[model samples]
Target chain A: MGLDPVKEEQNAALHKMRKRVIESIGRNMDLYGISLSTGHLYGLLFFADKPMTLDEMGSEMKMSKTSMSTGVRTLLDLKMVNKVWEKGSRKDLYEVEYDWYQTFTDFFDIKWRKSVEANILVLRKSMDEIDKIANEYAEDPEMTDMLQKDKAKLRDAYAYYEWLDRLIDTFENGDIYKLVPKEPPAKE
Target chain B: MGLDPVKEEQNAALHKMRKRVIESIGRNMDLYGISLSTGHLYGLLFFADKPMTLDEMGSEMKMSKTSMSTGVRTLLDLKMVNKVWEKGSRKDLYEVEYDWYQTFTDFFDIKWRKSVEANILVLRKSMDEIDKIANEYAEDPEMTDMLQKDKAKLRDAYAYYEWLDRLIDTFENGDIYKLVPKEPPAKE
Candidate 1:
C-alpha cells in the first residue's frame, strides 16, 4: 500500500517541504493582524508530529523566553489555538485549532459583531438626519414632498438593519452552527 | 411591474438602507486597509441619482474640505473608482465599481501579493525545522525507517497546498471561467 525504500526517501522530502509551507502560513497571519506568534504558530505547526515545548519554540523563532510565554497565552484565549498537555511534560504547550473552517467562526464572530455595531451607529445617525430634513421642509410645498419620500425610504432601511442585528445576535449566542450551512459536510 | 404602495415603500426603504450601509462601508474602508475615501464613497453613493460634489459628503459626515480633497485622489488611483468632470463646473464626482466582483481580483491581488510574500517567509522557517528533524534521524536505521513512513503521509498533504495555491492562481487568471458555471451575462 506504500512506496519502496528509494521512493520513500523522495516522499519524505516532499512531506517536509509541505510542512514548511504550512508553517510559513504563520508569517501571513502576523502580517494580517491575525494575532498569532511565531512560537504559537510553529507550536501548532509541529502538531502534525508531536507537541513542542516553550524552550523549543524560543530557539526555533529566536524569541525571548518572556515573549513566548505571553504569546502562547494570547493564542489560548482567542480559541484560535489550544493547549496540549502531553502525558509526560510538566510545562505547558500550545497548538492551533486544527479544524480551520470550524475555528474561523470564533474569529469571524468577533469581526462581524464589531462591523454590525459600527453600521448600527451609522444607520441611527442617518435616521436622525432624515428626521431633521423632514422637520426643516415641513412647510415648503415641493421640498415637503421630496423630504417625505426620503424619510419613508430611510425608515424602511432602518427596520432591515434592526432585523439583521437580531439575526447576527442569534449567531453570536453559541447556536451559530444551527444557522450557518457547514462547508463540505462528511463525504461518503 | 413593481409592488403595491406599501410593498413599494418597503423596497425603497430597503434600497435606502443598503445605500447607508454601503456608505458606512465606504467610510470604514480605511479600517480594513481598503483605499476608498469618504468623498469618493459618497460621490459613488449619490451618483445613481446625480453627480454629487465633495461638499455634499462633507455636509453629511461633517468632515472638512481638506479631507474630501485627499480622499478623492486615492479612490481614483485604484481604478475601480474614478472621477467625472462636469461641463462648465470643476466639481469632482465619483462612481462605484459596479462590476465590483471582477474588480475584486485587482483589489485582492494588491492585498494578497504584499501579504502572501511575508507569510511565506514565516512558513519556510517553520518548515526548515521539520527538515532538521528528518536529517538528524536519517542516520539512525530505525529512525530512518520510521521517517520514511512518516514522510510519505505528509508529502501527500503538501501536494494539496501546491494544488490549492495553483488552483486559486488559475481561478484568478480567467481560464477557470470556462469550466465554472456562470450566471447569464447581463445586458449592457
Candidate 2:
C-alpha cells in the first residue's frame, strides 16, 4: 500500500537510462584494449542484491570464460569493485563499492603506486642505456644541446610524478578525512 | 669547436634513452589499458626523420591492419601525437611531439574539456536520480536517513569536480600559460 507512485515512475525512467549507460560503457571496452567487457559486468554487479561470480558475469555478457576472468581481475585491481568469497560456495564473488572513499583507495593502491613504480623502472633502464651512448658522443655540440633538453624534460616529469606519489601517500595514509566530515555538530 | 666532449657525448645518450623510454611505453600499453602497442608505434616514430603511415605502423609490428588502425585512432584522440599530411604524399603521416611543452598542451587541449564534461554528466545523472528517489521517499523513516547520507556524499564529490573543471577551464585560450609559465620565474 505504501509503494511510492512517483518513485515507481522515476524508477521506470531510470531503468531505461541505466541500460543505455551499460551499453555505452560496454562499447568503450574495445577502446581500452583487452577483451574485457566491464559495462555489462559492472552493471549486473551494481544492481545485484548479493555478490556475483565470474561465471555469472561471463554468461550474462556472452563473453568468453577466459576474458571474464581477466576482466574481473582488472576490476579487482582498479578497486572499481571488490571480491567477496562465500564460505560455502568456495568460489570468488565480486561486488562494486558504492562508497567513494573506498573507490579512491583502490585507485591509490594500483594506478598511483603500482603503475608509477613500473614506469620508473622502465625509465631508469632506458636512461642507463642512453647514459652510455651520451658518453660516446660527448664531442657533438648540436646533439649535446638537444639531449640536455630531452633529459630535463623527462627529469621534470619524473619529479612531478614523484611529488604526486608522496602527496597522495601522505594524505591517503594521513587523517585528511577527519577534517572533512559532512555533518557539523548541532549547536546547543 | 665550442662544444665540450663530455657534455656533447651526454646529449647523445639522452637520444638513445628516449627510444628506450618510448619503447617501454609501447610495450606496457596493456597495463594502462591503452589499445595500441604503444612501444612499437612510438619506438619507430622516435628516431624517424619523417612521419610514418598506417601501413608502416602495422607492418612494422606485424599486427592486424584493423588493430593498427584502431590503435592509431586512440592515440590521435589522446593528442600525445598527431597526424600530418606531407606535401606530395598520398597516405596520412604521423608524428609524436619531442618537446614537453608542446606535448602537454596537446594533451590538455584534446582531453581537459571533454573528460571533465563526461565525468560531470555521470555525476549529474546519478545526482538527479538520487534526488528523484529522495523526494519520493522523503517520509519513510529509514529511507530518509539513508537518503540524507547519500545526498551529502554526492554533493561533496560534485563540488570538488566542479572546482577541478573550473581550474582546467582557466587553462584555455592561453590565459594560464602566460600567467603561469611552464616554469615559474624565480621570486625576488
**Index of the highest-DockQ prediction:** 2
Q: Measured against the native two-chain assembly using Cα atoms, what DockQ does each of the candidate structures obtain, in the order listed?
A: 0.13, 0.18
Per residue, candidate 1 scores C-alpha lDDT tens digits across B37-129 of 553354345323345567865664467867766665555555556577788877777654544334445544555554554444444453455
Instruction: Show model 2 residue runs off by greater than 4 Å.
Output: A1-14, A21-36, A53-69, A85-91, A101-105, A138-188, B1-19, B28-34, B43-74, B82-95, B99-116, B122-188
Estimate the TM-score of every prediction: 0.50, 0.59
Candidate 1 residue-pair clash tally:
5
Clash total of candidate 2:
8
For candidate 2, what is the lDDT? 0.58
Please provide TM-scores computed only on chain A for all of the candidate models, following their numbering.
0.56, 0.62
Q: After superposing the true interface residues, what Cα RMSD does each candidate give?
A: 10.7, 7.6
- Screening candidate 1 with a backbone cut-off below 3 angstroms (N, C-alpha, C), the clashing residue pairs are A20-B127, A23-B123, A24-B122, A24-B123, A28-B119
Instruction: Show the lowest summed lDDT stretch of 10 residues, model 2 chain A.
Output: A176-185
State, as a TM-score between 0 and 1, how close model 2 is to the true structure. Answer: 0.59
